[model samples]
Each structure stands twice: as structure tokens, then as C-alpha cells.
Target chain A: MTSSRPRPATIGDIARRAGVSTAAVSYVLNDAPGGARIPEETRERVRAAADEMGYVPGAGARSLRTGARDLVLYVRSDAAQGPLASEFLHGLSRALRGLGYTLMQYGAERDRGLEAARAWAALRPAAVLADDDRLTRAGVELLAKGGVPVVGLGSDPERARGTGLSTLVMDHRAIGRAAGRHLAGRGYRDLAAVLPAGPPLRAMGGERVEGVREAAAEAGAAVRVHDMAYSPESAAEVVAGWREEGLPRGVFGYNDEFSGLLLGALLDAGVRVPEEVGLVGADDLVLCRMLRPALSSVRMDGESSSATALRIAEVIAGGAEVHLSPWTPVPVRRAT
Target chain B: MTSSRPRPATIGDIARRAGVSTAAVSYVLNDAPGGARIPEETRERVRAAADEMGYVPGAGARSLRTGARDLVLYVRSDAAQGPLASEFLHGLSRALRGLGYTLMQYGAERDRGLEAARAWAALRPAAVLADDDRLTRAGVELLAKGGVPVVGLGSDPERARGTGLSTLVMDHRAIGRAAGRHLAGRGYRDLAAVLPAGPPLRAMGGERVEGVREAAAEAGAAVRVHDMAYSPESAAEVVAGWREEGLPRGVFGYNDEFSGLLLGALLDAGVRVPEEVGLVGADDLVLCRMLRPALSSVRMDGESSSATALRIAEVIAGGAEVHLSPWTPVPVRRAT
Candidate 1:
């Protein structure tokens, strides 16, 4: 079955077919300076032979020889789900492509820290942009030793500073704070925060809850935290429990999708939004505006972060050091 | 700055530091059968030297020598957005990983045609899974010539047969047919189909509309198609127009996200759901059960499709020919 498929033509095959030396074929194919010295007849023959044979220079071979690559690998600790992460990745891919680099998203093994780093290092990518948890101290050192620039996304800048990795700090706490302040200003004294129940979302959920706590304390408001899975059934159960115990008029769900789920569950349970429960979510998604009462949210500037990450990649590719401040989340108010 | 960063250790560096032959280092590092002849003291010394120096094998050099890669590149014509695509990819990634393969998602240039294929071919991936539109005939031929198996997802199987590329037919039209039949059975005579406005979604939307048309024609029902962008503003405008014209009671939005948007828009306009408008969506997303009226959807077996794709990929990797039937879409009924 393998023989049924045509084999890729190699430089050796092209040279033999063109009746030229391997060096001449390489020169012609790469358009090297020495190619000018080759006879015009020989060059044309080489070109025609290459075209007929469908020859594509192997990226692996070229990278090994040049010690550089046009590939930018983004390694995530887990799969990126939901609309906000998808949009951010799309924006980042476009930004990197505009700079003449291909963005490849790779899902790394969660527990095999050093082994995963070794696998990624083997790719010889020009740069590796990763989620904070994807790379440990040893993993970062291994990649740096392999001459690959590493950038940490959604990580602490101070920790990244010691490892020489450029960090793009995503302040989930700031998002929580924004949502908390917005709900408090709306005169909602009793508040509740919905945290997603998953290992991947645990860190983020904790930071958000802390931020909400800080703001709630400042506003002299009482706050309760709820751990819920990202499923309709879980949301309905929470709504049912809340209805029985009296619901908090102002609540902050993790993101728009979760917030939308909570909102729907409330409406399904015969609860009126805003009048009975005003809700806020983060990552001001398109769904926010489409919801019944509309949803208020905290907007993270993904475009700015993507642009900054690209710029930092450029500097790192040039063997330069760069530092940037963490991004701040802004509140977007709607009907909710 | 490049000088400031440490360099990775090579085989020669390990050999010299450990006072062993390069062949001995290779045998020890690769854990070759020949390592049994080497003394235990020398093996331990070599191992310590390699680890202390942080030596990692170069993937580029390895691929160039072995003529095979561990990469299965999944190139989407556009970004994977929303819950359905994301979930499918996540499942595919996990399945592939379990089979000892890494799945890399690449967003290809929408209009680059053959040039894009050349870029992908240069990478020398073991397999390429792409949308039907991403690869032209020439592109498919090029990849096959390079000894890379190609798989087309959500494409015409007949066309795939001609190209010798394994295909996983998603049957979007079947999804539409299912939705149409469900809506018609519910006794809704007037039906409207919402199609998203974008190049990536254009093909899929058309197929779904065609399926709805087929079912509507059989039922002698009137069907209208609406072109709307995936935004709240667009949805609100659609609702406003519908209200002015005395809207259709049954609407088949492209997917759950769009259906949710339309449902919210209708509710915000003081329209009662189900009582005034019956809605159906596809993908049976989590949002379905959360909505006030609980959206009815076509449940696409993404997990089954993903599993089938992985199985086919494994067969292709082993130089075997395998054919499977297209997946069927099942309609799931809920409140709406």
C-alpha cells in the first residue's frame, strides 16, 4: 500500500535525472549564489526536473542545518475550551502569521513535566509560548539549554523573571475585582461567586474568588463561593439550592458561558434577572449581549495581549530581553 | 544575550566529559541492546554527564535520519471556535495521544491554495487532517507524494476516494434534515433557517440549508434562509425584522450558540418562546438544557467521529487501506 503512493523526489533523484552534480542541484534548488555560475541549460534542466518530480525541501533538514525554524509552538497544559480562549488563540495566530511565523498549538502531558519538555525541545521551534503550568523550573532550563526562547502566558511575572522567560501575566484577580466592584456599585449587598469545578480551572477560580472577596470586604458585603461543574444539570441544582435558601441578587460567574448557564438556570427556575439576581461574568463574550436581560461582564483585552506577546517573541528571537506589565481587566456593563 | 544563555550538551560533549566513546554514549543514551556489553560504572558516568549537561535529542536530526515523524498535523481552514469544534478536537487529541501520536492543530491560510500545501509538506508530518476546502487536488497529490497520509474531515467521500485520501464525512446536511424533520413533526408549517456569515462557515451553512430544504419540500412547508453574522447586534436586527414581518414560529439556527443568541433576542423583544417561536439547534451543546425553553438540537456524535478518525489515522500510518461509513446525525427533542 505504501508503494502505491508516489515517493517525494529528493535532491539526489533530481540531480541524477537532470544529469547534474548534487551540488549543482542544491544550488539551483536553493537559488544559492553559486547557482549563477551553473550553465543556464543545466539550471533550466534542474528546475524542470525538480518541478516534474514535485520536490519540497524538508523543513526538518533545513532546521537542523540552519539552527532556526519558522515554527512558533504554543504548548498548553490542557485543551483550551470556550469562546474566549478560542478567540484569543485565533488573534494570536493571526498576529504571529502576520510576522511570518506559523503558530502551532500543542497539548502537553500534565504530569510528565521533564519528559514533555524534552519532546517539545526536540521540535527545535524558534520559540515556545506556554501556559504557566506546562513548564516547571527544570523544564524551562531544559528548553533554554536547547537554545529555544520560552514565553509563559497567564503566569506570574516574578517567577518567570528568575527563569529568563518572558511572561504575559493575565490578571484573573483584576477581572474578579472589576466584576465585584460593578455589582457592589449596583447596590447588591449580598453576593455569590460561582467557581468552575475542574483541575484546569482551579487556579483561575481561586484567584477570581480571592479578588471578589477583597472587593466584597471593601464594600461591606457578604460573599459566598460555590463550586459547580460546567454542566446544565449542575447549574440547575445550584439554582434549586439557591431558590430554597433565598438567592443572592448579585452574582459573579467565572465567565460568560458559565454566567449564561447560571442566568438560564435562574430563568428556568422562575427567577427574574436583575430584579431578583443581577449577574456578572468575565471575558465579555458575544453571548453577553444576546442573553435575555443581556449580561454585564469584565473584558480582558485579548488583542493587546496577543500583540504584546508577538512583539516579545520578536525581541526574544533576536536574542534580546524584554519585560512588560500585567494586563488589567475592564468592566463592560449591560442590562444585567 | 545569546551568549548569556547556556548551550545544550551534544553527544560529543557527553562522550568527552564522561571519557567514553561517542558510540558508547549513543548506546547508553538510546538504551540500545549493545549497552549490555558496556560496564555498569561507565554507563552510570555517561548517564550522570548527560543529565548534568541537560542533553536532549534534536527532533530535526532524528526525523531527517529516520524519514518518519511522530506528528499528526490537523490543519483547519479556519479557527476552531465554539463548543462543538473545541470538544471534538479535545477528544481527538486525547485519542491520538493514547495511540502514541501528538496532534498539532494548524490554522491554514484561507486563500493560499497550493502554496499552503507546500508549507505543510515541508514540515514532513506523518499525517495531515484537514477540512475539505483547505487542500486542493494538487495539494493532496503533493502530500501523498511526500509519503504523508492525508485525511479529509467533513468532506465529500466520493471526492476523497478520487484523491486517495481517507475521509470522515460529517454529513451536515443530515443534521439539517434531522432538525427539519423534528420541527415539521412538531406541526410548524412556516420555518426559517439561520446561516452564519463567514467564509469558513459558508460551506457548512449551505449544506445545512439544503438539508432543511429537502425536508421542508417533502412536508410542503415554507422555508426561508436568513444570513446573519455571529454577533448580538446581528441577532437583534434579525429579531427586529422578524417581528415586523410576523416571524416564522419554527427556526433552525445553525448551531446551539446561534440558536441561543436568537432565543435571547426573541425573548428580549417581548416575544414568548415556544408559544410564539419554536427553535431548534445542532450539536446539543450544554447551553441547550440551560435555556429557559430548553433548545431542541441535532446531536452530532462528535466522540464517535473523533474515534473513527483516530482509527483511520492509525491504519493509514501502518500503510493499510480502510473505509468506514459516514456518521448519522440524531435529533434530540427538548422543551423548544
Candidate 2:
């Protein structure tokens, strides 16, 4: 994929400058312990010379030699979305960009999971970061069979080697627990969770609702549930009808975007926040702090989407498998 | 690259199901308009079959065979960005995703102008949506040279393409003029535009400042320009120091994010909205509605980023170049 750009300075230049051989330069730079028996004095000279001359090794050249590059893949299912989940994507994209790697979003496209498998095989990515863990075992197997490493984000990691896909489950139930814990502590007896209508959001939303319900139930607090369409119009309609259809004293919005929309409608109707209705959102965007009276929300932060992408690129590059760490939700106290 | 799994239906499948040739299906879908003369009866039957079979023609195959697919490229240049430009991308993303085409954010690394050209070439995109009209003409020429249709989003098309790339200018200066006239009419003698510190925002910010100046100039009102970083801490510092510095009676924030941030600080410092200091923002978002004393701002819908992608797709699909209608900024007069 690279063109023949010629005559760039190789490690030979640094070795010559350091009065050492190329082997010494490589050992010191790569930190290949025991790769060479060069004296410490020689290694120091090589490092100083390399730094002085601004000598740098090309990643492409290194990859060609070792058949491995530090690249991470953020493999994701095709998006069947309508600007929904954009904040997550933007966050991931910005974060991944910070980590430094090419990030690509992939999906099999409408019940073509196996075809997605075929596409994944052709790409031969080093590591897989499947945002959606629902990928079939067969999908995982095809990639593993190709000797590609994999890690499932928000998916089951236990089946990684079996299908060659490792999982990093996002504890949706934990988000619910956090939401329940916060609102209940605020001394609001009546509680409800407003969820958006969709397969993806439904699963995550259900976990959150269950957590709220379980916590509220244990506290002997009343729990109600409402479904939403993930739009300003739909949210307004839902909020407008809430008084007549059983308005809870406190509500946990499935996410920040949804919660913000719901809160807007409640305010439009002259309802007092934390008084008539306590509100909670997720995702700490600039707008959250900008909101009048501000918004109380759940903060979910950690290695961003870009970092995930860089890791995937590495797995694809070096053909190495990785264990994963996930960032979970934590409650941020702000005005209701 | 596909595995043993049966591939999904292609144009070939549609042709066979209709007992016609692949060319027939293409002709019917393309309508080739005045080019083809097929019986309405056959057309109806073909349409019905396609719908019943749930056939969405393959993007890859169509691009390969026809030299184009229904996909447009919205390139996010690293060199040029405007105030609240994300609102445009967000709107565009939704519009195009609704029409079905992935919205790719083209990042031009350190390579600048030609870097975007190289990236777009490798992707083999159907068309180009260049946000930065200032990219060297050679880069624009390179994209056109590759047979890729080109369009401009919020850029001066006439200047960028000269004769090739179609333009969709946002005309933000008009927004500035409107804002200036509104503030002057409200009896504010001094006007200030709090601009974000950056290269990308510089050009548009300058244009807005000019427009505001012209309006203030005509109305015989004094006007001033203030530059500050868009971060909360920086914006707060600017506002906090305003008292000793002789604050402007009316402040026009560069965009919603900046305005929103500055507004929050003003409120926190006990500065009243419209009473002590009148304020205005641009690119209305959902949060603007939620801001207490509701935000009085300009709304420039601009071209939807996703729709830009769809249009480029259509051009690649052999449709005429798109004539994007710029979104006008309207004053949403609420509490402010």
C-alpha cells in the first residue's frame, strides 16, 4: 500500500553517529532486553546520538519487518440509527483520535451477520472491539479461525477464545443501580424510568429500569415505567400526558439526551425540578452545565472510543490478544 | 471475501425474480428519466417485487459496475471550522442517516489540503463535501480529476471550485447583520461579540464581526470586539473582568456553546439576562430552550451533514450536482 519513497536515514545513521553498530541502536530503542550483549555505555551513546540527530524509525517499516504494528480495531455492528447515539460516537471518535489510530465502523448490514464475518475475515484486523456483544458465536469463530484477536465491548468476554472473541461486558444493571441509589437518596418516594423504543436502547434501558425498580422496591418506594420515542416531540407528548397518566415524583431518564428533552418539557409546563419532579440525566456534556438550574446526571468516563480503536489496530497489526478494562457510570451531583 | 454463507440478493436477484435482465432492473430504478421508455405495467410489477422481496441494492456492486453509488462524502477538514459548526454536522448526520448513507468525518492529518485529497481518493467516495473552500485549488482539482463529484458545505463554492465543485455557502454575515440590528433596536448602544480563540473560527468570526459592525455603524451605535477562549474558565474570566473593563451593553456570543457557557457564568456572578446585560447566541439547540429566561439566539440550520452525504451519493449515482439551500438564522425571542 506504500509507494517507494527513497533514501530516508535508517538506524545506520544513528549507529554511525554513536560510533556503534546498528544492532546496538535497535536493542536500545526496542528495549529488547538481552537481545544484544552491548555494554551500557554503548547503549547510552546510541540513545544520545539518536536524540541529537532526531533519528526516528518508521512504523510502516517496522511493521513490514515484524509483521506487527501497534494498531487497534474498534469493530462495531452497522448503525441502524437516526442521529441517536451520536454523543457516544462523537465521544468515542474524539477519544480514539486522541489515542492515534484509524477507526472504522463496520456492520454486517441487515441480517447478514455471516457476510459481516466474511468482510471481517478479509480485513484481518489484529484485534476486534465489538461495541455490541450480540455478535453470533459463528461470527466470532470466523475471525478467530483467521487467527485474528478479538475483544467484545459490552459483550460476553467468556466466549473469546471459543469463538476467538474476548468480551468486556458493560454492566447495564449497574447504571440502573446508580440511578436508583441517587433518586431514592433524594427522598422522592414515587419513581419511574422513561425508556426509548429500540432494540439496543431497550436492553440497556431495561437493565437501568430494573435497577431502579429493584432499589425502589426494596425501599418500599412506588415505581412506574414509561416508554418514549427518542425525539423532542415524543418526549414533550410523554411529559405533557404524565400528570394525567401518573407522574412520578422522581424519574430516571435512560440517558442524558433523553433526560434533557424530558426535563425541557417538564419545565415548559412550569413544573418545578426536585420539587414537583426530580430529574437525572447521563453524559456530562457542556450543555448539561449550561442548563438553567443545571441537570443532575450520571458520569461515564474512561478510555474513549479512539483508545479502543488504537488497541484494535494493534491487535490487527501485531496479532496479539488483549484483556480489557471498562469505564462504568458514576453519579455526578448537580441541580435536579 | 464472502464465506460459504449465501450472499444476499443483488440486482441480479431482482432481475431474475422479475424474469428480466439486470439492465432492466437498473433502467427501472434509475428511471434514466427521458433515456428509457419502458411500459408502466412492467415498471409497477418490478417495483412491487422489489418492495415485497425487501431488496435494497448493494452499494459496493453498484459502485463497481456503474462507477457510482448513492453515497455522498462530507469531508470535515482539519483546517477550517466555524462557530457551532457541529450543530450543522449533527443536523446533517440525522438528515442523511434518514436517507441511508454513512456520514464519514474526514479528518485531514498534518498533511493539510492534499491529505484530504489522498484520504478521499482511497475511500473511492461517490462525491466530496469539502467544508474548507480554502484548500489549495490543486487539491480540489485532484478530487475532480478522480471523477468524484464535489459539493461545498458552508464554503464559498464559486471560489473553491471556480468551475467544478458546487457551493453551499451559509452566509453567516447575514446572521451577524440580523443580530446587530436586533440589539440596536432594543436600545443597546454598545455591542460586543465574544469570539472563540482558534484559526478555524477566525475567518467566520471576522465576517460576523464585520456584519455586526456594519449594522452598528449604520445605526450610529458603538460596537466593540472581544476575543477569548471558548472554555468555561476562560469565558468566565472574560465576563468577570467585564465590570472593571466597561462591559458592552449587548454581547453576541460566537455560537451556542460559547454563548451558553458565558451565559452560565454571567448568571452565576449575579449578572441579569436582558436586564443588566442583553445576550444572544447562534445555532439553536435543545439546550437553548431549556435555559431559564430562555436564550434569544439565531438558528442557522445550514446543510445537514448526513443530507450532504446523501446528495453526494446521488451525484455518484449519476444525479445532477446538488444545489444546497443555506439555512437562515432566525431570532428565537424568548426571555432574553
Candidate 3:
């Protein structure tokens, strides 16, 4: 591997190594229109040459020539919120970075302020990935108006209609049903559902809460609905003040972060779980399992966004618009 | 608020808004002596105009005018092998971004890759934020010879004296001692520490493992160590097969992620924490408190990275060098 032999192999070097011209190399590597005219033997030789010479193309250069970065944005309504958002971000960043695309986070929740979007818009991202339903309509419009494609990560597909936003919805209703049905099956009658205080999650949390009510009703348990702001202290305060409401034997947190918070507070207040009060959380992040008693919740597959990113790139590259479906959640049981 | 307001609120806009010439506005804004004398009343008016118009300078534009980006590269020996590296990075990025400088990450951990100083040189960052002790003398010489200022982010501040790299000394040894001492205070003599596995984390995990051994010795506990791979399933499998070693009353996971894994696995095996076995995990992430019993361990001042990033920016902007002591960790306890 002498420097003279092309210290870092370029596409042209690969073509030269394969006894072909740069145009043929572009045809083979870029999926250029004229690639069909290139002989199969020559294409194989170019590929083999590239492999042998470790000819990984410069991503920036490719983006310039192809007019695509293959990048995706994961927009949070706000940057400062939730372990799930952060986890999704960490994984998505790591995953996308691994796949050779930049993960630009667009915050619907801007810690950096509103001009942040205008600034981010300058990056000319290939697509907009938003989670908020209301924002999905507005964001799809916001970005589409700016000539950027949009995809909804964990949003309701049906609700996103007419916005031209492709969907990768996370079925929060199914998650609530699983949790509610799980607790109802544990033979509990009196039950309470805890939801997020924010409107962004009420749709999902409310759906889940409704599911719990429906499931508990079917199991013949009188259901009580409790809207508690998430936070260990807040959850504890709610439960502490509500002892007179006849403490329900089961509680479902809006998500794993809240579930874990409530679980600890309940245990600290000397309320037992499953034995006295069962807990069900959503998303089932890795941390859920890290808790001492373990956390059980509805597992939403995480790979959908990555897949959506891939599909979004396809769409932007002038491929046919492929419809994506909403995600379903499954029940996972751990200690609690 | 009209677009056609007398001024648009740029430097030029400020001059127009204040009814002053651009040269007078520039002199007032820069606090420079006017080439042609400008009155103090004019300066005050210029300042008021800038404020009313809500004009602020961009960091990049400032850097361009000043001949430096104020950016720093927190170069790593290997990101995969590090525990503190991620924390260091998270803190550094949060800090640098807040301070108007970009933070870049790079690794030279593949052996003699330290001689890979060319990557560091290519970026021409204001400073190379790195582990001074980890880089070979040749590597450090190569970077320093190129006139690139370096800042060390590790336990070996003294090592920088030999290499001319300014230091941010972090005490991994102290982190171990703190965890070990806390567990010992809980009256548990048999201690087991879960170290991270993999070549990237080998050095880091070993360092913490050493720190634990030192603390355990002082605490009078016979310590046995375990190396677990980077996955929850791996931690579970290790715990599942731990009958041969016998259960320790107190255990410290290398970090919160691993600690969470251990907690989950132990709970699944029906081990009662503190009652049968006490558990402690480091990094006071939200999940720790969210857990049923809640995890207890050391709390590193991760939020302090902002200060560190600001200092690095100063160094890049030709500010005097800084030396930071290793951040202290506080013992945090919950029910367990």
C-alpha cells in the first residue's frame, strides 16, 4: 500500500486500476443512465478494482454530483425533553452516521429558538422527519413550502393525510391496550391511568388511557382516569394526595421514562407493584429493563425510522412514492 | 417590523437605524478608536440602535474576520473503547455548541495510528482536545511541531508537561474509590465490579477496574471483577452463569447503562436488592431514579462540559491556556 499507488483510492483510480475510463466508473458507481451500455465484464472489473483498492467515495463529492445528501432530520417539537427522544436520537444518529448520512435534528421544541429552523433550512436537508401530529401538518407544509420532502416518525398515518407527509406512525393506542389488558388480566378491578400533561402526547396517552378504560371495563373493574404530569416527585405527589380516591391496583405511565419514575415513587411510598399496584409503561426502552424489578411495556420497533429514512431518500431521488405503515406495539413482560 | 424599515438590523442596518455612517457604527461596535473622531452621543445612539434592532454577530462570521474558528477537536484514541469519552463528548459538545464553536471527534486507536496526527492537522482546529498520556511522544511531537495547541481530557495532566498539551485532568481512580467506599459503607465486604468489554473500552474499563480494586482494598472487601460485553443480553448471560462465584451483597456496575443491565438481570433471578444483594450504578441518568428501587451511585458533573467547552474556545481564540482539575463525583443514594 505505497502512497504512489494511490494512498487513498479514488473512483478514477479504481477505473484506471480496472483498465477503464472515469466515465464508465461513474456509470457503474453512480447508477448513471449509461451504465446499461457498460459491458458486464467491465463493470465487474471496476467493482473488483474498487474493492481491492478500498475506494470509498467522498460522501460530500457524491452529494454535489448527485444532488442528494441522503440525509434525514428527526425533529423534536423541543430539543429539551425525554429519555425516549434522546435515546431515539442517539440510536438514530449512530445508525444514520453508520449508514453514511448526516442526522440533522430539527426541534419543534427549540431550545435554540425559532430562527433555528430558518438556520437549519440553510442545510437543505433531503427530508423532514417530524413526530408531532399537529406539527406534521404544519411541518410538512413548512418544509414542503421550502421544497423539502417530509416523513412522519411515530405519527398517525390517517391523520397525516393531505399534508403530503409519508407516514411511519407509532400506534400509541395499541400500546395502551396492551398495558391496560395486561393489568386487567392480572385480575385487578379498580384501575387508574396516568397520562402526560402535555397536549403533544395526550392523543397517544389518551388513546392508551382509553384502551385501559375499555379493557378494565370489559374485565368488570371500575376505572378511574388520572391525568398526572410526569416526574417522580409529581407522580408521587399525585398518588400521595389521591389515597382517598381509593388507590387503584394498577397504573400505566405514558412512556418508559414516566413509568420508571412512577414505579420508583410508588415503591418509595410503600405501594407494592403487581401485588398491590401493577405498572405498565410504553416504548419499553433499554432502561425499562434496567430497573431493579424490571419494567414491562409495549415494545415499539425502533428500526422504522431508519427504514423511513431510506425510503425518503428514494422518494427524493425521484423514485415512486412508497407508502409506509404505522408501527404496532407488542406486550413485553418483565418484573413489573 | 416592516421589511422596508429605515434599517434591516445588520451592522450596516445599525448605522442606518442610528442615522450614523457605517464607519462610525463599526468603530462604536468594535470599541475601536475612530479613524475620524466620532462623538460619544453618536456611540450611544449606535448602541441603542443595535439593541433595538436585535442585531447580533454570527460566530462563524466573527471567526472569519478574526482568522480562527474557535473550534476544537476532542480527538480520541478510540470512541468505542471509552466510557468517559462519551460523557466527555456529550459535555464537550453541549458546551462547545453553546459557546459558539463546533466540536469534532476523531480516533487514532488502531495501533501506531497515533502517528496518525495528519487527521488532526487536516482540520486545523484551534486546539486538539485529547488524552495527553494516551498519545505517543512521536504523535504529540508531530501535532505540537505543527503548532496545534492541545488540551488533555484525562487523569494524566502531568503527562501534558512533556508534550505541551494543556490538560483537563479527570479522576477515574477517584470514581472507582467513591463507588467502592459507598458500597463498603453499606456494610458489604464481598464486592463485584462489572467492567466494560471490547478493545475500545479495554483500557478505560481496566482503569476503572483498578480504581475499584484500590477502593475495595481500603474498604477491606475481597473484590472479584467481571468483564461484560456491550449488550444487555451479555450482562444477563454473565449474571445467569454467576452461580460459581456466589452472589456478592454489593455490586457496582461500571456505568449506569451496565448497572441498569445488572439490576434487571438480578431482579429476574429473584435477587432482592439490599436485602439479598445491594446494587449501585454510576451516572445519575433519569432512568436510575425511575427504576423501582432507584439506582444509587456517583454523580459526575456532566453538565460542566459547557465550562470546559468555553475554555477550549478561548484557547482556540488565542486566550491563555487553562488547566482543569478532574471533575469530582458525588455519592448519591436511594432506597438501596
Candidate 1, residues B1-336, lDDT tens digits: the string is 335645456899999999999999999988888878999999999999998888887775567656657788888766556677776677677767777678898776563457887887777777888877887888877777777777777767776665667776678888899899888999998999998998778788999999998899989999989998888778888899898888897999998888989988888888888888899999888778767788899986544645675686665566444445545789998876
The candidate with the higher TM-score, 1 or 3, is 1
> Model 3 over residues A1-336: C-alpha lDDT tens digits?
321211234577777789989988988977788789888889899988865654545333454466555556555552244545554455545555555554544333322222443333333556656665425243344455445566656656576666566666556666777788887777777777887787767667888877777777678877677677756778887778657566788777878777777777777888777677778788877766676566788787645556645555565554233456536677788765
- Per-model i-RMS: 2.5, 11.4, 11.2
Q: Give the TM-score of each candidate.
A: 0.92, 0.67, 0.66
TM-score of structure candidate 3: 0.66
If the candidates were sorted by their DockQ against the true structure, best first, what order would they fall in? 1, 3, 2
lDDT of 1 by residue, A1-336 (tens): 334645567899999999989999999887889778898889999999988877888786677556557788888766556676676677778777777778898776563468878988777777887888887877877877777777877778776665677776678787788899999999998999998898788789889988999899999998889998888888888898898888997999988878989988888888989888999988887777767788899987544646775676665566444555546788898976
B1-336: candidate 2 lDDT, tens digit per residue: 433322233567778888877777878976766426778887877777665444544344344456433345565545423325554554555565566544545333343465556555545555666666435566655666556556666666455444566666767788788788878878898888876687677787877878788889889998878787767788778887887787788888877678878888888888888798888877776656656666788876545566554655565555244555556777766555
Residue B216, candidate 1: how far off, in angstroms?
1.3
Q: Report per-candidate TM-score of chain A alone.
A: 0.92, 0.68, 0.68
**Model 3 agreement with the true structure over B165-246: per-residue lDDT tens digits:** 5677656667778888888888889988888887655566677778878888887887888889767798787787675568
Q: What is the interface RMSD of candidate 2, in Å?
A: 11.4
**Candidate topping lDDT:** 1
Question: Candidate 1 vs. truth: CA RMSD?
Answer: 2.9
